[model samples]
Target: MTIGKTPPRGETIYWVNGKHPWVSISDMVEYGTILTTKEKVSVNAEKLFGDITPTGTLLMSFKLTVGRTAILSIEAYHNEAIISIYPFIDNEYSARNYLFYILPIIANLGDSKDAIKGKTLNSKSLYNLLTPLPPLKEQKRIVAKIEELFDKLK
Candidate 1:
């Protein structure tokens, strides 16, 4: 329920998944963020979606089909449909996967009105939701389990 204080374009703004053709809007658009292979000091907006953010931010879909969450694993900018979260500043640090898991719960808890017809969860409605925060250690454990299960699938 708190409005985040965002720095200007270059001050504290770091985009992850900096590669185009990576960050997409569902299955239609493509390459929303940017791509950088920098080992450190890099964030990626694409992988952030269903992925993680290191020294990063969270991106929530804002347009069309909204409320989808993303994490900044690398530094990059995101589309307007996404609301970025800087856990470092907010003191809300948790594993990116943990955010992905809990965001769905928040979205379901929030109000749902079909403003754009089928798109009931637009950016405005989705971003205003709140969820509980688990300790970083617990989050890490959860993320590890998530990765372990996902790795089994591959």
Candidate 2:
């Protein structure tokens, strides 16, 4: 997991039709896939402000309105409120799939004192959260089961 980067608050980052999709908090969709972003920034702006989050990475918002998760369908840059989550393991796809499903729990583990407007988790809280990591096969099973139940919801 890595935090996304952003330009300064007043910077000129958005363009009418820029070279990179710039995913911000407003662009996120709960348990949805981001094929394209509503906003774009220049290539130079992306180079200066953020790194490219490759396709298939999971993103979760951590500031203001927390707990929204989205799968990246295109290579893009994101704002600081979002974090890129992808596994660095041999079974990359499986591990990431597991994390994507469990992110809502992690997002809600914030302190209760700030529950009125929803809790915002800082980087410290985010990294400190304990997540269950079963074996690769088990994770795949869990993902499959989750998808099965989700399909039933439709």
Candidate 3:
């Protein structure tokens, strides 16, 4: 969907209260990597806004659980309010590894406590989050180094 041409908020198909996965903001946690699923599973495409390919779309709890980002280690459906950011990487490119490295950066940024109901993260404020970008090559190197060190620590 083009930014300027995107449908108005009222016209867009958004996830409502009932359709969302009701998890506590504190329960939502971030991990360096998610365990891979052995069996293949089909998921609803509507839960995700953009591409649904595993490792392609990065899922983050953008609401009250801000900074809890996770890469789709396996092809699974996400709930509404989950901040799904998928870089338009073709089948040849994977952003999952990079997302793992960047998750820390996002988590450290802090979450907004002033929610509409004092229980959820304000989506409007979530969008204004500042994400630092590094060169592609540098990102790759950072991912590799982090992976190596984490492996040793584990």
Instruction: Give lDDT tens digits, candidate 3, residues 1-154.
Output: 0110111235234422233222222333465333343222122223433443354446666554556665554444444546556565423233555765675466446456665743344555555656555666766777788879989998
lDDT of each: 0.48, 0.80, 0.48
Q: In model 2, which regions exceed 4 Å deviation?
A: 13-17, 90-92, 111-118
Off by over 4 Å in 1: 1-55, 88-95, 120-128
TM-score of model 2 vs. true structure: 0.87
lDDT for predicted candidate 3 compared with the true structure = 0.48
Best by lDDT: 2
What would the per-residue lDDT of candidate 1 be over residues 1-154, giving only the tens digit for each residue? 1122212335322333234322334422221222443322134333333333333555555444545665545544333344555554233455555776566457766776755435455446655677676777878778678768878987
How many collisions per candidate? 26, 0, 2
What is the alpha-carbon lDDT of model 1 when measured against the actual structure? 0.48
The all-Cα superposition gives candidate 3 an RMSD in Å to the true structure of: 7.7
Structure candidate 3, residue pairs in collision: 63-121, 64-121
